[model samples]
Target chain A: MYKGYVVDKALLDKDPHFKAGCILCHAGNDGELSKEKAHLRMLKKPSDNLRSCGVCHKKTAANYAKSLHYTTIGQRTGVMPRFSEAELKTFDEKVFEKSCRSCHASCGDCHVKGAPVGGISIGLVAKHKFVKKDEGKTCAFCHGGRVYPEYTGDYGGAPDVHYQKGMLCMDCHKKAEFHGDGTAYKSKNEVPQRPACKSCHPQGKEAKKETQVAHSLHDGKVSCYGCHSGSAYRNCNDCHGGHAAAGPGMILGRSPRDRKVLTTLRLIPTVRDTFAPAGIKMEHFDAVPNYWDTPAHNIKKRTERTRKCDVCHVDRKNFLTKETLIKNGAKANEELIFVPKAIAR
Target chain B: MKNRRTFLLAFLAVWILALYGAAVFAATPNKCIQCHTNDALMKSLHKPPVLPKSEGEG
Candidate 1:
């Protein structure tokens, strides 16, 4: 009746989710009066199997099974470049399956209840009610460390313009992005319908001539976040043996994915010795840069760079340099360093 | 008159049996909720939080 296991009696008759009785999803001896007997074979998270919800939601369950959120293949793709064939095999068995894949979200995690992060849960989301979407309770728990906090401005500076306009994660990131479009994408970058600034704010649509000129000038040269990132976002450092340290920073640099484009970047936590604990020396450590281009969640309408062009073209502030790079990082990180040119007056 | 009396008696018997079945179905409580709804029972059953094996990505 209190926290984790409370079920509203009123919803028992009203909601179809409960009509089949708890035993249908959560297998247990409902006939037994003794507490221990009744809970003997009960499933703590029935949705972990997906079939529990799949019985009624066939299409969603089938698509979700291949979704990045459910499969968590993106984590493996990000780190695979650093590993050799044999090392990757070892990593898949030892680290990825045992650790990363455990983080995948199940049906109940978002709908019926909040997922258990770090073995702690918020319990039933609304007295066991099956909600369509509840970003605050569901998304916030997993992304609380960075994205959510950055979006809400709870980490440091003002909240994102989107958040100020009363938008949640699902507002921009559509349900199909979470539910999957029947493609087993290796990484989120390959997701076709993933949220992009250009999707909402197309170029040349700006009412102000100055804004239109700025967009036109920076079309392919600069990324939206390069100038719009409002404040310092979290940069994770040195993750080894499943532990990582994080710090706030605003790093502007050449995109690792495309050096021609300048954008906001964040320091990845992987280091040479990051996998050494698991006996992986990372034979190809330099293959991937330590700093990867990030779509910083803390976006603003006007930032220091937007207000004064001199901030970037003249002073070249926040631009990554060899001197500012993390010590003992991969040599590839040097490639991400970019220097801005002076503006023509 | 005899046939009419027999039909009435059969109708009453079937109705009584249906009511009995409905009562029995309604009385069968969901055992999961029976214990979970008890505040004191749940409080007593609560265990200490388990330590996480690893800190996952955000």
Candidate 2:
């Protein structure tokens, strides 16, 4: 009922929660009393570390320790970065945490996630399952330019498909590719993801026959992603082999060794059960709760229910067996067995 | 007959030189150290390999 300033003491006093505090995060005396110490003290509050975060988060802390946020605020101004290294002075550590992570978390506040074992009760609603949502918003919120510099026009700027569409960082950068240990480069290099052409069409083979690469040879060695994952493609030397094209590129991909399945498709199922933390060895995002197969696709079916060999190897007349493909020049031992033949120097 | 004899001798000489050159390039570290006392190339090898850039580049 109080419409103007300085007239709400009696009205808001009816509520116990509202009447007990001056601010949500800050509490102290009036401003006319104790210098600027209240504001300065509010700025220096330490972030609440979860009871279990450090038991597993030391290495990241080390990397972030050397970062600028730790150097400046964690040491100098005494504030911890709330978000991640993608927001602020991302060129360095300190600014990135202070500007990006801290801005989202401290100001944005608490998050909730699904419990590994417990059911969702009414008691858990305060913590919305929004850590990734908050992180994605932190990236595109203000300074999304570090990744997308052409943000001036309407056609581009963090992709129009992502803006307020409930889309996230993983949705585009790597929707289908598994995010194991959150890095694609360092994991056991087995079963390289056959990047799905899903977004380019509908999921699977109702997909229009989009022409990508016309390989002269339908050999097992060539793959769609072996050539195109970046803005520009380096020579074969940079990826499959060392920076010297003198040798065959390292076939880091591991298919089942003892089997004789030819070039159509393969799956190396992760040993862990789906309920466990280690369930996904490949880090696939759309993880079926109990499924363990990492489906390496050479094709997607017409109905798309079964993603198999025909998506690429449609020339049914020339389906070569494993031995036949080897005779046609797929390397004899391509599991990276040799030390790259000493680089042929 | 004379031309055939010359061709055989020429082939023999080429084979001998090529085989010997392979053995020399595969020389052990001790033998290489005898000539390369400064050890500059050996030291450089331990670093992550960089391609020998053409001139006027980093």
Candidate 3:
């Protein structure tokens, strides 16, 4: 009698979840013939509690529990470095769980329901149907602020050539990567199922030798994005929670994560003193610079920078300079400023 | 007899027109049904062909 609990006849007969009836995952008063009685205690997103999914997908549940999506460790690492020892303790014990960890995804978030992003939770993804993959709804919903938009040309610039060929996210990102092959990887880098440009376009086969020779000139100093990221990309400087204004442009910076001396740049939000509530005083607020080794997804076969070597070799203005840093209000970003000049390199 | 024949012919014409109209309406499938019961869309997207059981029996 519950309007939301419309049973599919084929699903009821064929599927095991329905074979046990809706009560197994969604605990409600299904026995009562009356609509009011049957609707009592109905669970909308059963995977949120994890009791239902864990009963079936124990291994995957255990793995996903430790995933970056679940832990949000990157954000913690970025923010916690600036906190004093005492401040870190307070953040870890009290604030981290509620403030930071609330951004994490439960099992239901991707598969069955919308995730909380930009401070809003969306409705059921497929009207309570369990979808295996819905890139537009699931992945884009979470990563929409950056990667997903760039991939589809929604942010600006031409879409990733891959998407033009009708290649969806799952085409490259296989099931094992999403399902967490029982690995509790800290970052995306450690995931064995993680994809690289070389995985699909090997150096000799798809990437011609001429490209390799040109790549060698950089001496592994610059990221592929340094040359190949076409047009400008959306970047935000002073992101205070969900409210950050973005502009389309490019910057070059050294990475803290991999120590890549030259890399395609992005603005660092959550810098020192960000998201610290009214009363909580931070002693070493500016202790760490949060400039990350970013994989800017605004990719193309050739970019304005890559078209001519002299564009980067001769051009000092395009590189992230003291003036540019001051203009972007990122002069305080000491980690990014110390990179060797493009001309000298 | 002539009047009777004319009445029967009119009734037959109305019946044919009604059948044709019903057929035309039925040709355009319901939007909700088109998505909810669309097997091809589900299969192409690699959404589960059948929902799995609680016991891992899909």
Candidate 4:
């Protein structure tokens, strides 16, 4: 049997997904003997159109249709602030619809086969089995660019504490997060079911008195990633049209979403000329900062900052400053620069 | 002898009908799997993945 296309003949009688025959979802001539005649107009990825899965899994399919993974509307929301009314219209038509929307994940991408990233795919998740969850193949393939690599320490220093404990993407991020609760949320931040560090590790639950004191002191002022980001994470620079060169570095700055809170920030590749190829000038380029708060995946039980308060309060290590800021970045970037005050003994 | 002959003819008819029913109405081997499961055929069709020139970070 072939590696990817091998289907266990035994499953034909057992699995209901296959009971209706391959023709039920993958529309093709099952009666045709020749390969050429059989695959004529076959839906290579039947679940691309949710109706294939929605026919059986009504609720999950209906919810997944509106999920951030499916709609990918967060991409548009991220840069919408920088566009003028006419520019927004142009971006919607040219850049977003053409480039960004293609990244949306379909139902089959996770359950049946791995989604193609940059035009390369792993073909099938298993031997054509409808797996409940295969984060290593599915999540790792799509998020491999940044998050997954960092989580596993392939991109940098020690692997995340959670990975060391054998936790995966689905551990914290539950099924409801992937299959929406019937809300057409524009950004993932708006999703009520999104994973938060505090959800699992509550503040007052620290084992040691020292740890408990630290958590209380920085509870609202600092984000968990601000101190726990293990090492340098990837930062993209100078994105033009749809391409950007990535580098390794970690930047701690005020959260662009909530400036009062300090958090791990990643440089967004959007520059003034980012949409120029599509004839967009991004008239209000200074409206949004180039850095955005990112929950860095390379978390550790003990980091340089966590080990010593001096890394932040005294040395102010990894903090974003005006000089370290990207040249030709938006003027709004200046607002994100923050200096941690020294602790008084 | 006539009774025995009649019984023999009925059995022959039943056997033939069963064979015809099995050929026409029984489950056919899934043609999709027939070619897909052939390793040699898939290997012959395999080509190196071509990376797209697009600006996707993932």
Task: Provide C-alpha RMSD values for all models, in order.
Answer: 3.2, 35.0, 15.0, 4.3
Cα lDDT for residue A245, candidate 1: 82
> Backbone clashes in each candidate structure, one number apiece?
0, 12, 2, 0
Candidate 4 structure lDDT = 0.88
lDDT of 4 by residue, A110-216 (tens): 89998887777888788788998999999999999889999999986678999999999999999899999989999999999999998889889899999999899
Clashing pairs in 3: A16-B53, A17-B53
Binned by DockQ into CAPRI classes (incorrect, acceptable, medium, high), candidate 4 is acceptable
Model 4 spans with C-alpha error above 4 angstroms: A240-243, B1-23
Worst 10 residues of 1 chain A by lDDT: A1-10
Tell me the spans in candidate 3 whose CA falls farther than 4 Å from its real position.
Answer: A1-10, A32-36, A118-122, A181-183, A206-209, A241-243, A326-332, A338-345, B1-58
Over A56-126, each residue of candidate 1 has an lDDT whose tens digit, in order, gives: 99999999999999999998999999999999988998889987887899998899888877777888888
For TM-score, candidate 1 versus 2, the one ahead is 1
Give each model a TM-score: 0.92, 0.25, 0.75, 0.92
lDDT of 1: 0.88
Order the candidates by TM-score, highest first — what do you get? 1, 4, 3, 2
Candidate 1 residues lying further than 4 Å off, grouped into runs, are B1-23, B38-41, B52-57
lDDT tens string, model 2, A1-345? 001001223333453423333333234322323235434444211223321223345554334333332233322111112112232222235333432233222212222221111111121112212243343333333323223221212222222223345544455444123222222232222314423444454323432443222232222453332222111111111111122221211121222332222222211121222112212222221221111112221111221212323422342322223432222121322331211112121
Best by DockQ: 1
True contacts kept of each: 0.50, 0.00, 0.00, 0.58
Query: Which prediction has more favorable DockQ, 3 or 4?
Result: 4
Q: State interface RMSD in Å for all models.
A: 2.7, 35.2, 16.4, 3.1
